[model samples]
Target: MVLKYCLLLFTTLQFIQARKVVDLTHTYDKDVPKYPLGWLGLENFTYFKMDTLAAQFIDEMWIAFKKIEYYEHQGTHIDAPIHFGSGRQTLEEIPPERLIGPGVVIDIRNKVTNNSDYAVTVQDILDHEDEYERIPPNAIVSLNSGWAQKYPNANLIFGTENTSDPTTFHFPGWSVEACEMLLQERQVSVLGVDTPSTDPAQPPIYPCHIYLQTNNVPLLEYIANLDSIPPRGTTIVLGAPKVRGGTGGPTRIFALIDDDQEQEITSNSASRNFMSAIFAFMYLNVFRFC
Candidate 1:
């Protein structure tokens, strides 16, 4: 019976270890939509053939380079604290550990569908907590407003009838009350959104950004594929360029899924010790007999 159980546990461990990685980033191209604000979007990528077989600096050296210009906050990007808040930490000040963590996706797609100008409120957070329990500390809380499907559509994605007018823009995002709950009360480290900003478009002032930046919480904007990730139980890895004193920059975000539900690979030291004992028992008794 011990040997049988040991084999079964080993197989289960192997299965759990084979984690699946989901890319939660959008590919930025010329066609990709820019935020309706007056800033110029990504410049056309200019490529130059530096060397070839006939025009090579060395015998077998071939090289090419491209000049690309885009706003730091353009595409799938991270907004460091210094983006808005004065005397706050920049991109480099955010430690690597803070960039990755267990994540929860707060989906407000239905609300967005009903009202494009809807804002995620404190009640939404409380409701999610009532259902899913308290969100883990230092977790990356992602707001999925279901706007990613309209990517590359400058008009639709920004929810603006006039691309030039910021006042006409409309979309779903975090309300000030919601930010207070998540940042001040829950102490979440990062806030990610599928939209252009954490606040609803056309806010009198970007209160969500102000609150988060003042509190030194980074924001990940223009994230894609939140529809694929679960509401909770996945680990998020943020890949962004670490520019010293950078106010913000583009980032690549991803997640690792191990199980279908709350069931996850063990990390508790006591559980690890218990598993070790089982492994030792199997090696000493079952393996020798075999």
Candidate 2:
């Protein structure tokens, strides 16, 4: 009986591990969204063939190339301590372990809907602390606060629009205290948010940036579709940007692990977002060290 029970348990765990992976990344088009006050969009780019390539197309088609000028911070990206720190590691210097890890998603969409700028507090983290021990130390902490509705129109992604209507714009950011909690107390590897930034859009630029950097933590912004991940348990893989000394670069994000399809799709709107992310980018990559 004991042997039989152990075999059954192992089989169940294996079944759970066999679940599929979902891509939670948004395809960056010429009109990738931005914040209500921010100015960002695709740039002028062209693909042309050089001497031999042009000659090949007209004559041959060999020396061909594509070129454009754009910001490294465009699209889904990650923020490094150097983003806010005077002297810190750049994108290239960032380790793959630091970029990717177990991902933890926290659902606060309802709270955010009530107040666009509603800051995530320590209570918010503690409110769901029942699963705190499960959140690994080097994991990527993601906060799902449902700030994507405002970006239905690509114009808002640039953060520039008429403010006459109250629903014109909204952003969910982390509070200074909450930032301290994740940085100083929790000591997470990285803090990710499914919004324009990790801090509230107010008089200050990035409170989370200041605190996290001071505390040796990093931040990832413009992450969408966190609603689909479980409040905990899902492993997060961070795809670091290939920028040299840049402060921040876009990211292709996702959540991996077993999440009840019923709650993720029908019952839990937040989990739906994470599922959406998994659907977007199917090719999930593990870390590579040279």
Top-scoring candidate (TM-score): 1
Residue clash pairs of candidate 1: none
Candidate 2 minimal-lDDT segment of 10 residues: 281-290
Alpha carbon deviation, residue 207, candidate 2 (Å): 1.7
**lDDT by candidate, in order shown:** 0.79, 0.64
- Would you give me the overall lDDT of model 2? 0.64
Off by over 4 Å in 2: 1-19, 34-65, 131-134, 152-169, 259-290
lDDT, candidate 1, 1-290, per-residue tens: 86677678777765544455789988866566655444436343431122223433565677555555565767788999999789998998988888999888998988987798888888898888888889999899999988888886879887877866667888788898988888778889899889888888856359999988988989998889888777887899999788998998778898987554423433434544565686688678776654
Report the alpha-carbon TM-score of model 2 versus the true structure.
0.69
lDDT of 2 by residue, 112-231 (tens): 655767788888888767755545677788787765544436445423365322244456778888777776666688987767677765543676788686555667776766665566
